[model samples]
Target: MNHGQTAPEDRARPLSVVLAGGGTAGHISPMIAIADAVRRSRPDARITMVGTPSGMETRLVPAAGYALETIDRVPMPRRLSADLAKLPGRFSRAVRQAAEIIRAAEADVVVGVGGYVCTPMYAAARRLRVPIVIHEANARPGLANRVGRALGGSVAVAFASTPLGGADHVGMPMRREISQLDRAGRRAEARAALGADPQERLIVVTGGSSGAASINRAVAEFASSGRAAEAGVRLIHITGRGKEVLDPAGSPLSAPGYAQRDYVDGMETAYAAADLLVARSGAGTVSELAATGTPAVLVPLPHGNGEQALNAHDLVSAGGAILVPDDEFTADFLAQTVAPLARDEDRLAEMSRAALTSGVRDADEQMAARVIAAAEAGRGEGRSRA
Candidate 1:
């Protein structure tokens, strides 16, 4: 044997972790946050991510400086259809692809944040004897995460009411910027960065990454009403990609004290700059609001499984946020509710404190520790088998 050669038994394997989640920022953001946490704690850890080939992860995971593997988008049908007839073959192929990735990575543990790829990844991990850990970001668990939980994994949830049995009630994992933000200290800087008037209270409105047409229309109408300007408020409207409101002249809409952007790269600065927020109550948004103590007027999406309403319920009840029905979130609602709320310094401060009380800033570190522990346990099991 070569002098440089070492026995396999003497070589220590670095921790191998495979994370799966994608499609929406809600899933992918937390997945990446947790991955960052794991790396901070275990620098030698080899981390890989899995997502559907068509999901947002194709762009985001690579941008976050992590290796990503893709599989087919195997959506389980809620109702029988032609797609359902083709599900078996598609799912089988995806599972095989997932298993191959896991084997090639020598993944000691699989952590799924909930998405289309998660069901197959969970199944493959189970078949491969790799330990699984799950983080469910919504109050109502999704089908894939529910399946993962049933298949027996350590489960964590952003909300205590998530109904994933035995799930540890860990809050949502957020990127370092949002998690560590000192809103008060950075308020002036953040406002300056966004080009807001330092003396005026700023309201940041976002419809999440994909944008919301109704919210955009309502904000444009509110801008035309001039109520926000009259109240000495400034507005940063994140209209989402391709969803900008336009005037009769086909130019983007404009009003005094109103600024519009299709997107903001770092939402933490937006959260810091806002005295008030108007946005949908996606799990990620709610958690970030609470974390940064940015009080919000939340408009839940009218469609979907009604999880958005459920996601905002606790924060609204906590007096940290307000919830309005989608159809009722009109210009008048903004003038009467959000604009006035923005101008009320004392009330805004109270809501900010309440939001902070409801937030969890350490979930990323907490989830990372849990994931690493699961991986270590799997390593123990493998050594025992050997």
Candidate 2:
């Protein structure tokens, strides 16, 4: 296997690859990045994404120009209950649907980025003897990827501390726009684009696509407290769609140096204009910040098995970011921590340098290469079976 490059004998044969993962941007984004990488390496490759009808992948996958195949979502129940009782039957049905998709796509390989859909996809791929590659985007392994690892699939992880067995640290695959961002060069234009004062320092606050209510409320209260303006710091707050809208009337966030939007279609510009980030430490968000060399104050989500805190650990230890609990990330905390950080130019720059030290700019290419190798191996296995 020549890694990312298609094998000489296989060059004439168009590759068919099936990508599985969805339900959230964290899983879907990496899958899209790898899909783009695969398309760049093999323009003729037939890439099909498997997701549930209700997932964000339904829209995101089609928009990314890949064929999407839907499967029933079968969420695994953690405790003994009625849902647990229904698990086996739902899982079996989902696996059957996924197996049909794999066969129909003539998938040479199945790549899974952990989500509810991944469990069935992984099981189906294994049953069909298809090569499987799993990407775990969280620091702690999720249930689907954990099972994928146990099935002897090739595993890749965003963070080194991920507990998945046989995992290789491949870093998080970033979107093309973020990976190619030139923050220094685009700072002026980006600031202008977002209606920010050119000289004012900017802090970006976000909580993924759906937004974090706690982060939003904290920032809003901080804005109302008048500390951000006193420090001459601007804020760009992205409150996810359908969330409580920050009333611009009588709110400091509506003032000259502050801006609030429900969603930012162009995060690259927002990242370029930012001097600091105040957000949740989801795997994708953490990777993007590291890759962009942006300093941050990460408030991991309060729920969900403590994975978010683990995700932000290395960056915090490296001095690239500060980790605070969701409950502790209040207006006072922002006034004390974020205010000082924004005002201290030298400290912010140092943190930026530290962030870049741990970032992987070529993760998309690396993971794409791994997927290509797995596909080639699966083809060889199929031929041998024949």
Give per-residue CA lDDT, model 1, range 10-43, as digits (tens).
Answer: 2487888999999988999999999999999999
**Candidate 2 lDDT tens digits, 119-168:** 99999888888889999999988889898878878999998777777789
Candidate 1 regions with alpha-carbon error over 4 angstroms: 1-11, 383-386
Estimate the TM-score for candidate 1: 0.95
For TM-score, the strongest prediction is 1
Scored by CA lDDT, what does every candidate get? Answer: 0.89, 0.85
Worst 10 residues of 2 by lDDT: 377-386
lDDT of 2: 0.85
Pairs clashing within candidate 2: none
Q: Which candidate is the best by lDDT?
A: 1
- Could you tell me the lDDT of residue 118 within candidate 2? 93
